[model samples]
Target chain A: MTDVTCFSADCNKSKLFWGLLALGGLVMLSTLSAYFYIEHHGHIVTGMNNQIVWGLPHVFAVFLIVAASGVLNVASIGSVFGKKIYKTRSPLSGLLALTILAGGLAVLVLDLGRSDRIIVAMTHYNFKSIFALNMIFYTGFFAIVGLYLLTLMDRKLKPWSHPVGFLAFLWRLALTTATGSIFGFLVARAGYNSALYAPMFIIYSFAYGLACFLVVQTAMYKWNNIQIDEYVLGRIKNLLAVFVAASLYFTAVLHLTNMYFAKQWDFERFILVEGDTYPMIFWLGQVIVGGIIPLLMIFSPGAAKSPARILIAALLVIVGGHAQMYVTIVGVQAFPLAIFPGYAETSSFFDGVVHPYSPSTLEVMLALGGMATTFLLTTVAVRILKFLPIDKLDQKH
Target chain B: MTASHKPERRDFLKTGAVVAGAAIAPGVLFYGIAQGRAPEEGASSLVRWGMLIDTGKCANGCTACVNACNTENGLSGKTGPQDSQWIRKLNIKHLQTGIEHNLPMLCQHCANPPCVDVCPTGASMKRADGIVLVDRHICIGCRYCMMACPYKARSFVHEPLADQNPDVPRGKGCVEACTFCVQRVDKDQQPACVEACNADGHQAMLFGDLRNPESAIAKAMLAYASVEVRGDLGLNTGVRYQGI
Candidate 1:
């Protein structure tokens, strides 16, 4: 005797839902088609080469994965911090974390050269490799979060929610640390070998995930023809602003640390000034569009209260996160390894030169398909389950 | 009736010979081939396979080593950005001095290879004799090793291959690099590039066991100060260069 009243009463909603589902299905189908083509023809068909091994798909995957960890913060706040306002919203947050992870992981796995050998990847273990350790962290996140979700929804399990939520919170911190270390542990690379990357990634997860949470929360409210109370909206927007500020601080610290090292000067110059797309993306896409614009929308007295503006800010944050990931993952790889320090080196393999990469249609399709999957899964979960928060104050307003 | 029949000595001998020959032939063939093809039962830590390239002896525009590497490794020999190259000739000019030098660059075969350390599946590995190689069977084609190599030595197989050397098996989607011609080295033969360099009369490259004081590579190390590229990293690369 679950309450049917919790779900949307409008039968017309199904038609729109079905249409969205079909669109997601189509996108996923195109992704699969691209995967098959890459498999048959090999990586020669793509923009990837010996020099630029990773490209657009990686940016999408890394962004989604980092944001997935962030999405869980909503539930963590509700149960771990004992915020009653957040507790009502915990189910939706849990659902979102799971869906976003699914989407990100899909892109990562499908992009692998031997995607069919997933069973081998699962079974094999090289303890020294951080990537191997991430597999454990990822699987644990799913199990712990699933149990946490159970405690949130089931009446008998409600007592267990706080403890489970506490574990999930700790689990997510470790998960994000592991994700950051994937780049941080690169001892040879000019850009990545930083101990700072782990915490920076955690802060990034917070901002991106909360922004994602806000956007979805807004969409859900709009769809149900409900409006959240101004107080709750104010609280969430403030939290997002704080997270964004912390991320900005971390970004500044990371750059300052890089600049301090004499050897890293060339790399810093390339990223901050010399490189064409990287510098542009860093200043315009990441700092301006992702950071400053969103802060303006969140903090501006007139705009802060509007749901439309908040949603726009969240969207900008997501876009900016992608740009940052591109600069980090691809841009770093594009810069030549300092193999020959004193001399100008030349080779047929594009040594000592910035490698060029253009995203192929297939790669773009795969990335968009990941976003589609996230949307589709989130919509379906909320439609069938009582994930939406019912704010008494909002109803009264 | 067949069981009851008493066989003649000739028939009995003939039956015995056929049965014995069938059983012994395979064993004899296996032992003979295994003796020729198999590495010593264990790669001795006492032996460290290494290379010393004398840049002073290296000649400009000499394609001998590069060509031989391509032929021996079954590489397409195409120097395109997308093509796989196990070894390449590097032309370097000192920025300040304006002095030019030429040398063949390949996997440095570092004692502590970063590529081996970063590989998720233990596919990138170093043999006991210090020859670093990709276990292509286990390589999931993640290309993380490509990122980790300091020398830019490794290459990902971008396209499907044809006419690959059966002795040196490679597949598309796997990252590969200079194996130091392990197939030839195990049999006390020089790597193809070294042999071709010698044949071309440059004798710029010398390959030998570094552990043996009597070996040419060790004696050369004693006579000349050899430098590992990116020597500050303290990788102790087996491949060293004289007169960088």
Candidate 2:
């Protein structure tokens, strides 16, 4: 864990890096302990059960996985779209993609009922399953993105970065499609049946990925006492705003389309107005705090000059991203399946009523582990390598 | 290669004994058939096991079938939110008519099971005889199959189990559902639920091979207006309900 190669002549910079690493390591250890405890005690210890099978861990896992694809958007803009300022941020973007995905994937694998048999899960194939396809897409994205990062960093491989970057871009589109389809393809529940999920998640990644990039980049600048230019900052925030608007539009369409059908009316009411945690999260956490406020902050007069306001806006987007995932994953499962239409059913198996869920402390710890893993790995990698973007006044890609 | 050259004696008497013993040894020999099929034999595709449930004959508040299933599967019989219920008695009412019905709900064993289709490791699989089962040996317990099931028939074991029925294998961390009582079915016997229903004089559930036209369940289904639950899903579920 202490294999840091400091780039600066003064060794004093290494002390802070080591201290942050230790803090991350402590959290990582606690996360692993939670994993082991659940593994030994079984899922009975967790709030999850037959109903609400996926809980808080899934929210964190899916958020990170979906955002990981979005994180690569910075690199894609630089290499494939030929944005010179974005080119400066490509390495950091690529690094974030890997470390964040590792964290998300770790939570998913660790939360499995039979995590020890992960090998068998890989060897076994069910091509009809969207989950299986996502596994392949996730693995391929790592390889292509890793290569894309290498090509962008090495002088000799610079010429090939564009082609690799293009491949990575296409692969991520397929990746996000597969990710969204995990819920969309499911017909057992009313909340996930819409085909709009694929495109909606794609736009969400753009917003989430850009917001993540802005937060990390701003923090890096603040940490190093560097002042980011106003023009470059404005351009990036504008892109983020457009994505947020597109994502919001798709979300409205998804709900409106479902509302058009009488069959989906109950589910719509439950999620948007009737249900307890979901409606509040969807309205306050996702829509207001995540969408409107951030858009206002970004487009506000003199906003580009204030880095703190922009950073807060970006942080809010991340918060809203988690809220969106929570409402999508946990909220959907909390509603019981409509097995018998035109019938009010009740049983010991919880057939007709709304399922209850309360996240246990262990479950919360496990969820935080995914974020901690990303932070720990990112901290070490950034310290060891030169990931800072250099923005010249007349930069050319 | 001549038989006469072998040190061990070869005669028609020994060969005759083998031929005669083969006919009678099914129940007696160590390697012979024990329950319908020999140990090495697989579930036959010639049979598509099914059930026909007449809700009119199923009395409300009766839990004989549910009790029988729990006892047969070695379940704790707890009805908590986290408890595993391979089968349950669902009390449903038609909102338009206000007519109520109580039916024992379990795995429908659909010809096209969504659980089987969505399982990442092919652990939620179907036997040749049309019995949907979880191969716990390979099941990684992702629970994706549970989300795909329209019937909500599946249950994931939440706690470590003990003193399980030797014939019915179950474990924590794997998704499970009704197999039409596969162990009893393999032995050419009716499921415990069907037996309990009959013993209770409800005569509600009829189990037989759907592929065979002369089978009692088939004849009954043909003579009656039996329909598959969630038939709109186009699943062609093996379990049919009558008088709903």
Which candidate leads the pack in lDDT?
2
Chain A vs. true chain A, TM-score per candidate? 0.96, 0.96
Using Cα atoms, each model's DockQ against the true complex is 0.72, 0.76
lDDT of 1: 0.88
Fnat for every candidate: 0.70, 0.88
CAPRI-style grade of the A/B interface in model 1 = medium
Residue B17 lDDT, candidate 1, scale 0-100? 100
Q: Give the residue spans of candidate 1 off by over 4 A.
A: A1-9, A394-397, B1-7, B14-22, B36-42
- Model 2 segments beyond 4 Å from truth? A1-12, B1-28
Which CAPRI tier for candidate 2?
Answer: medium
lDDT of 2 at A156: 100
| lDDT per residue (tens digit) for residues A136-179 in model 2 | 99889889989988998899999999999999999999999989
Model 1 over residues B113-154: C-alpha lDDT tens digits? 989887878889998889999988788888888878889999
Q: What is the DockQ of candidate 2?
A: 0.76
